[model samples]
Target: MSSTTSNIKFNRRDFLRTSSLAGGGLLIGFNLFTACKPNAKPPVDLADLNYKDFNAFIKIAKNGAVTIFSPNPEIGQGVKTSMPMIIAEELDVAWDNVYVQQGDLDTENYTRQVAGGSQSIRFGWDALRQTGATAKQMLLNAAAAKWGVDVNELSVSEGIISNKAGETLGYGDVVEEAALLEVPGEVTLKDPKDYKIIGTDRKNVDIDKITTGKPLFGIDYKTEGMVYASVLRPPAFGQELESYDASDAKAVPGVIDVIEIGDKAKKLLAGEKVNWTAQLSPSAKVVVIAENTWAAMEGKKAVKAQWKFASPPESTEFHDKKLTELLDGKEFTTLRKDGDVQKAFAQADKVIERTYESPFLPHNCMEPMNFFAHVTDEKIHLVGPVQTPEDAANTVAELLGRDVADIHLEMTRMGGGFGRRLYGDFVYEAAEIADTLRKPVKMVSSREDDMTTGVYRPAIKYRIKAAIKNGELTGYYLKEAAINGNMYGLIPNFFPAGAVENYQVDVAKYDSNITTGAWRAPYTNFLAYAEQSFFDELAEEMGADKVQLRLDLLEKVKGTTDERIQYSPERMQGVIKKVVEKSGWGKQPEGTYQGFVAYYCHNTHVAEVADVQLENGVPVVKKVTCVVDCGIVVNPLGALNQIEGGIIDGIGHSMYGNYAFKEGMPEAKNYDRYRLIRMKEAPKVETYFMENELSPTGLGEPTLPPAGGAVANAIKAATGKRVYKQPFIQYDEIWKVAEKPVLG
Candidate 1:
């Protein structure tokens, strides 16, 4: 086990799997993986799972079946499949017979089991591989003892051990004895060349269940005597629940109870040393409990409540307007600075300055936020689709004045997280309602409720000023503006920041009551669009190919002795060259204009090219070619799928995604106003990975950063205009002019 996981107190529940491991079958648990930080949400699973001693991983059955328990929640990133592939490959097990199951929330047994930030494969690599290798050695010892022969004289293949004379025993036949042997702290792992299941394309563990209409998502979860619960929220931010009239809701048919969640939470935490890090209660809400989902929803529609909203500061009418005005305000912080930027600009032949903006976006998970809770006087049992089970359990414990040990958390295969479920506010609400009703309850957020009261992707505005001297880049200056002016999961001095001679970066803030958090790649989500698109424009000014310009920059940065430089310029150049060659950078078919972009994050590099055309004045992206270098591809098929999906998600969100606030309320109520890329709008995407022996990184997000820029640059190519803002809404007019949008 790693030193960090040792901090968690291991309880018996975590070690319970071991009992089954050494019993009828062999179950081997290895070190827990604690990859997530203490307080990160939004694309990082911060679910404070509080289970103990679950550090073990693999189990072998007497029937020659192998079961692998994946501790991390599967949010459609393929962790459940890829993590086990690592173990099976090292263990030399038959891939066909390996079975995978989702492990319960056991922070002590599993470190940082949340599934955000695409950290699953990267963090679990060493631990999971050791698990398989260690178990294999134990089994070898058992076989050697039975045969009274040296372990080295025995050869194993696909769960069977045999001597040169053909004396053999199945792995299952010796697994019982192996379980009693002491675990080796060190074991030999398989060479990548020897891997048969890893690099090969493998099916998802839940593909059969998913394709055949099995219950896998939180919405599909159910329990006996569990009534459906729903809530009605306050109208805007900074509002409080004064009083509620539940008579009408309770009168509705099938409605069991209409309770004020604030009152319930108050009672649950009454007079106790309870201080949950976050606000456990909703902004201002009322809960409806009923026999079923339909009844709960109907009852919620019938409910009404009075709200007392304290007046907020600032003359806030429209978000874009107020934010734009505040961009020039004095409240700003410097994040990075370099050589004399003003001198470089003064010496430049030409200078260009522009600002780019991206609006708040809802996660819009396919399954709306939902969780099931059964809160009793003694214990709390929670099960649902949450990104951060550990974080959630800890928060619930604080909210209810209970010990972390008394709260049990479990996660289902998520419909989608995209960082929304990380907060587990919905779980707190469910637990509170269940405690009040004294029955098991499942809480479901309506699309309106989920969208309106969400911790949205913070609306951000970025301004860049560049100085080009004699056809070469000279200086770069950037000032980012947001609700808090905080950059999330993205480094201000990453990539080109160190590559430039004179560079400076600053941040400006305009505080607001609306909550904001990470979405996808966070700052990189928009940073790539702004920086890469700007680079494309610069490439045109220098009469150079966009792809070659980036390569040239990487070539220059490689020899520089800048103390701030972090990435390997060689790796960056490698990905760029491979993508250019595969995409035929300047050699696309007639009328197929192509846009190209490259970015590095989470220790993975990706370059993308979107081939597009003008279809009825709207840009129709026909195809996208992508090249990835994420280190040794654990599951080739899975990695490719993630890259493809990320490209589509990036394009979809950048082009059609936008949200706004008017009078402290969300203007985009649901998908009807907010947009997502549909199948007809999706481009045919192709993915290819670089062959390397380096350790693997997660692929859930690397491809996303560059996609929006590729599509935008492609749009620029086809229409000869730049989109300075997101949600390229007006198809005809967007290409006619490039100007800062007028804030209403």
Candidate 2:
């Protein structure tokens, strides 16, 4: 972590040995030509490709093609393009001159390469820059030595170094010499003001390939003699395949073998014993060994399987009901506490209490969970569009009983992840099928399989109470209950650790057959909606402005006075203040309704104002004004895109998206049944960023939480009704209300 810079002195003899003649011009492959130089020394590890477990390699080819290896998976979040922007910015190269290659599974050189939590930019901010800067310094040192000029007087632009005397050399000419010099302990990184490419809207690096329908995803990856495999699981959450007649399945075209994969083998190979008691029922009997995806799919459809549904029909219903019941319980974990809430409520002139409920949601990534594995006697190659590649690699290596070195994982650009790719179950499933078949196999989940197979965002219930007197906020209480679904084991300590006083937050788990995992924004998605909605209600009851009320309450906990509150009040206020100015909060437009909400998460603060108008009883969101303080913006256009997309997606999830269960099975199947916000339904979105000197935070998930609250609050303002549930106000209901126009 220590930064260092040292002056490198290179003599004339060193320069000659590193230069080579190629097509009448000099061609230099740093290490290759170093031996021929006049006073050449042994090749130096100038850029310790092995330094501190570097995630990627930075190489300057003889032609000045600056190649960068990106370790993190890029799933349409623009990391494939934005991350290289950071490198080019520091390397002082033109964006067009840079080429990016996805890194392989190299645990020794790259650790912690999993991509999620919208942390790609933040993680690359330092590492990639340092790498580029170090390489740039080496090249400059070599050029300065060859020109017999001071290194400080030499400037580099677009991979070329020019001196005050007008003598210049392309990076390709000095790359060899630079490669022979000692790697600098520290290199000076460029300031943001000096950046030429970052903050600008650059086209995605893989856009052309994607647009032309090139093979850029896991589904497109194919190998010689590769076979496709599919698994058939029970239809219901707690159902198990008791028996199956695969005789007809084996008769299907291209059927190679039929092997049953059970929980016993999965447990033994995975090193974690199967907890039969914890399972809703016995694991499914998987049939592996196939010719192609279509063949397997067809065979699966023809197979007759007997499944036993052990879990009761009320499994989901019981859990949903339990969440509501917990909201009324007195005993709960205290997240924040200040004055006695009971005493404050007794003294208050008015007490307003309301409860809100949110249903479970599915990630429904564009690319369903899939993995391609080629397993042999010596090594195994796994490729996929996964969020957690490193974790997946390790799990596969361990399950195969092979050294980690024998496993190679290549992460392809995902269609969409949204936290769904964080799970490695699909990776394991593919590896298991490959190992069982002893061949290269790709395990692809059908849309139905992807939806029904466990892991969803847990349903939640919230109870909010606010005590007001003389139009001033005096006290507040919030209680939240949901299934225990923190995949990373972080939620139990999240809310209780900070900002609010007299806040009781408790999570209760009612054992159910269904499994749950992370969705976009996780708990914050529901928490912000509930908290912001309740705040809106409280503001109305107190006859106080919503923004002013929040500001007043925020002033009390502005600074980092408490360790539990991990958000910056100043950053929060900055976004809030910016949105207010940009949206003209106090100005009212005829036939338009406005509502505002702000939240802090993922180390970023976002405030949004939503403008809406009823169109024939349907809520038509006209525009949204969003202000964010994510510290230094990396790519302004990309950041804005993230905000805009998150807003639109959030709107859909809030007003129309819902995943319910009937008889222990999800009712919604696909986009047809599960509604999504289409292009025509999209609202006009305006985004603004706060000016700040702080380091960049995250932008992807921060804007999502406020969209629901902002829209709900706006609805409440237009109509004297409170929406306590998702998809609460239907289009037909709104139309009915609009038809009864008041006659003055």
lDDT against the true structure, per candidate, is 0.77, 0.71
- TM-score of each candidate? 0.91, 0.88
After superposition, the stretches of candidate 1 with alpha carbons farther than 4 Å from their true spots are: 1-23, 32-56, 263-282, 313-317, 559-566, 731-744
Kindly list the per-residue Cα lDDT of model 2 for residues 409-524, writing each as its tens digit: 88898988887787777777788778877888888887877887757888888777777767766666766777663332333223223444444344455556677766787668
Deviation in angstroms for 678 in model 1?
1.0
Task: Give the range where candidate 2 is weakest over 10 consecutive residues by summed lDDT.
Answer: 42-51
Using lDDT as the measure, which candidate wins?
1
User: How many residue pairs clash (N, CA or C atoms closer than 3 angstroms) in each of the candidate models, in the order given?
Assistant: 21, 16
Least accurate 10 contiguous residues by lDDT in model 1: 1-10
Query: Please, what are the lDDT tens digits per residue for candidate 1 over residues 1-744?
Result: 111211222233332346354448876774443212233233222223232222547878887689888888899999999988988887888888888889998766576676677777776666667667767888899999999899889888888889877998888888788867766544677777878888999989899999998999889888889899998887777676787788889988999988766654555445453333244543447888899888899898887778877656222345677567766765667667888888999999998888888888889988898989998888999999987787778767877668989988888999888877767778888887777888889999888888988877877888888899988889988878887554433455577877788988878776777777767766688888989988988888778877778888887787677655546788888888888898888998788999989888766888888999876676778999999888899988898789988999999988878776776777767776676888888888888788888878879988888998998889888888888888765332333543222211
Q: What are the per-model C-alpha RMSD values against the true structure?
A: 4.9, 7.5
lDDT of 2 at 497: 30
What is the TM-score (0 to 1) of candidate 1?
0.91
